[model samples]
Target: MGPLIRPLRSFANGLGLAWWARVQTHGPDVTYWFGPFVTRGSLERELPLFLEDVASEAPVSIDHSCLRCRRGEPFTIPASDG
Candidate 1:
C-alpha cells in the first residue's frame, strides 16, 4: 500500500481527483499545499506528521482542511509581509 500510493496519487492528480492537505498558518501568514494523495483516508492519516513538522516552526496559529481538487506547481504560498 505504501509503495502503490505514489503511483495512485499521480494518476488521480492527473485526472484532477486527488486529495490534498491545505494547511494555513498565521503569523508568517502562509498557505502550504501538501499532497496529491489518492485517498482522503491516506491524507488524513498522514496530516499529523506534516502538521507536527510545521508546528515546529511556531506559527501564531494553524488551520487545515482536506480537499479533493486539482493543483499545479508552487505549492507554497507565503503572504506578503508588506
Candidate 2:
C-alpha cells in the first residue's frame, strides 16, 4: 500500500483518530475548549483559528478521555529520598 493512501484508510474508523474537528462556520469568534488532553496541541492551533472564523459560538467542548481514566490519585509523586 502506498503511504499516501494510509491517511485515507482510516475513513472507516474515524472515531479513533486523535481528534476529528469539522469547522462548519467562520462567523463565531468564541473558542471551544475541547480536550486540553488528547488533542491539546491540535486544539490550541485550531481553537483560535476556529474562533477567528466563528466568534458567535460558545460552549466549547474540551472533550478528552486521556485524563478521564486516571482519575484515581491523579497527581504524580516524586520517588522517596533516603
Candidate 3:
C-alpha cells in the first residue's frame, strides 16, 4: 500500500493538490512545511511525530494548520508575516 502510494503522492504534490502540515514555532520564529501527503488523513496521522520532534527544541509556542496547496523548496523558513 505504501509503495503504491508514493508515485501518486508525488504526482499530486507536483500538481499542488497534496496535503501538507504547516507548523509554526514561536521561540525560534520559524515555519516548517512537513509534507506532500497523498491525503489529509495521512498528513494528520503523521503530524504528531513531526510535532514531537520540533517540541524537543523547546519553542515558546507551537501552532499548525493543514493546507492543500503547492509549496516548493525551503521547507523551513523564518516566520515572516507574524
- Candidate 3 achieves a global lDDT of 0.92
Q: Local error of candidate 2 at 80, Å? A: 58
Tens digit per residue, CA lDDT, model 1, 1-82: 6788778888899898999999999988999999988889989999999999999999999999999998877899999878
Runs of candidate 1 exceeding 4 Å displacement: 1-4
Q: Each prediction's TM-score against the native?
A: 0.89, 0.28, 0.88
Q: What local distance difference test score does each model get?
A: 0.92, 0.35, 0.92
Q: Return whichever of 2 and 3 wins on lDDT.
A: 3
lDDT of each residue in 1-82, candidate 3, tens digit only: 7677888988998999999999999988999999989889999999999999999999999999999988788999996774
Leading candidate by lDDT? 3
Judge candidate 3 at residue 50 and give its lDDT. 96
Instruction: List the lowest-lDDT window of 10 residues for candidate 1.
Output: 1-10
Worst 10 residues of 2 by lDDT: 65-74
If both were scored by TM-score, which would come out higher, candidate 1 or candidate 2? 1
Clashing residue pairs in candidate 1 (N, C-alpha, C atoms within 3 angstroms): none
